[model samples]
Target: MTTNQLVEQIKQKKSFLCIGLDVDLNKIPQYLLKEADPIFAFNKAIIDATHHLCVAYKPNTAFYEAYGIKGWQALEKTINYINEKYPEIFTIADAKRGDIGNTSTMYAKAFFEDLAFDSVTVAPYMGKDSVEPFLAFSDKHTIMLALTSNAGAFDFQTKEIDGKEVYKHVLETSKSWKNAQNLMYVVGATKAEYLADIRNIIPDSFLLVPGVGAQGGNLQDVCKYGMNDNVGLLINSSRGIIYASNQDDFAQMAARKAEALQKEMALILG
Candidate 1:
């Protein structure tokens, strides 16, 4: 989807919520295991229930990679379902991938062409040669990791390079890459206040923020510092919403959790 289309979805839905479909068999409803593809079954139910409450759905690739071939198949089905059923809603492959230039191009093709995800998360530590391949695709976004929610982010992201933090350098430098307009970023919600500085660097770029709810990041604080005229944030809530219940009402409960966030976003937008 185009950035304008994604912005339109946010306006129409009154939300910038991005639901993470990081399905775990251990936490999903027991009854779903009876289905041939339990992961897809769980995802379908959740998507069907909560589609209207959010504008995007992000599936962390690790969850599908863990289950091998069947898991991979489920991942394919899930993305196809979203594209066919809800073309208006954005889809992100939360696959933090980046490698050598050639390798990165293949990875980009895997997610952008074969799977047809609107966006894919990538690691920029590999520099321009590695990340530029993904940014080459038209209309497909490459969401680079910036200041992450994890405690380990301080190890390098905050470490000063010359006079600025590495992440600040990242945001400033990435803009010079080819097709940089297709670039988005991953800024963890845990560092809400940091967004003030981040916004100053790239006020117009969209940020895919993960760490609300289960991770204890405040929704309002993120918006207070991160939001731009387009409401440039996709606040993700994974465990808290997807695992709201391991019972049969899981999908409905997920929708309720998403709706609560959407309502909170509507108020923030107003």
Candidate 2:
């Protein structure tokens, strides 16, 4: 989807919430295993129950890749289902892929053409050549990893390069790339303090922020610094929402969790 389209959805829904479909079989309810395709079945239920409460859905590729072919199939089915049923909802393939130009092109094609995701998360370690291939795809977004919330982020992202943090360099340097307008970024909610500095670098670009509920990232703090005139944030809550309950009412409970967030977001927007 186009950036304008995504922004419109956020406005229409009164939310910028992005639900993470990071399904792990071990964590899902045991009853879903009886279905023909447990992964897809679980995803379908969750999507149907909560699609309206949020504006985006992100399925981390690791969850599907771990299960091998079946997992991949389920991932495809889940994306297709969302595209067919709710094309308005932005879809993200949380596959932090980065490689050589030729290889990155293939990865871009896999997610953008074959699977038809609206966006895909990408790593920036390989520099412009690795990321431009994905950015080249029209109407699709390449969300690069910037200041992540993980403990290891300090290992390099925050480390000073010359006089500036590596992530600051990444954000500033990325804007000069071809089709940079299509670029979004992954800024973990745990590092909400960094959002202000991040916005100063790229105030208009969207930010896909994970690490909210489960990781204890404060939503209010994220909005306080990260929000723009367009409300440029996709706050994701995975385990906190999807795993709200593992019982038969899992989908309902998930909706409740999503609704709570959406309500909070509505107040923020107002």
Candidate 2 residues lying further than 4 Å off, grouped into runs, are none
Model 1 collision count: 0
Worst 10 residues of 2 by lDDT: 1-10
- Which model scores highest in lDDT? 2
Q: Per-residue CA lDDT of candidate 2, range 152-216, in tens? A: 99999999989999999999999999999999999999999999999999999999999999998
Q: On a 0 to 100 scale, what is the lDDT of residue 107 in model 1?
A: 99
| Residue-pair clashes, model 2 | 0
**Candidate 1 local accuracy as lDDT?**
0.95
The CA lDDT at 214 in model 1 is: 84
Residue ranges of candidate 1 with Cα displaced over 4 Å: none
Q: Rate the local accuracy (lDDT) of all candidates.
A: 0.95, 0.96
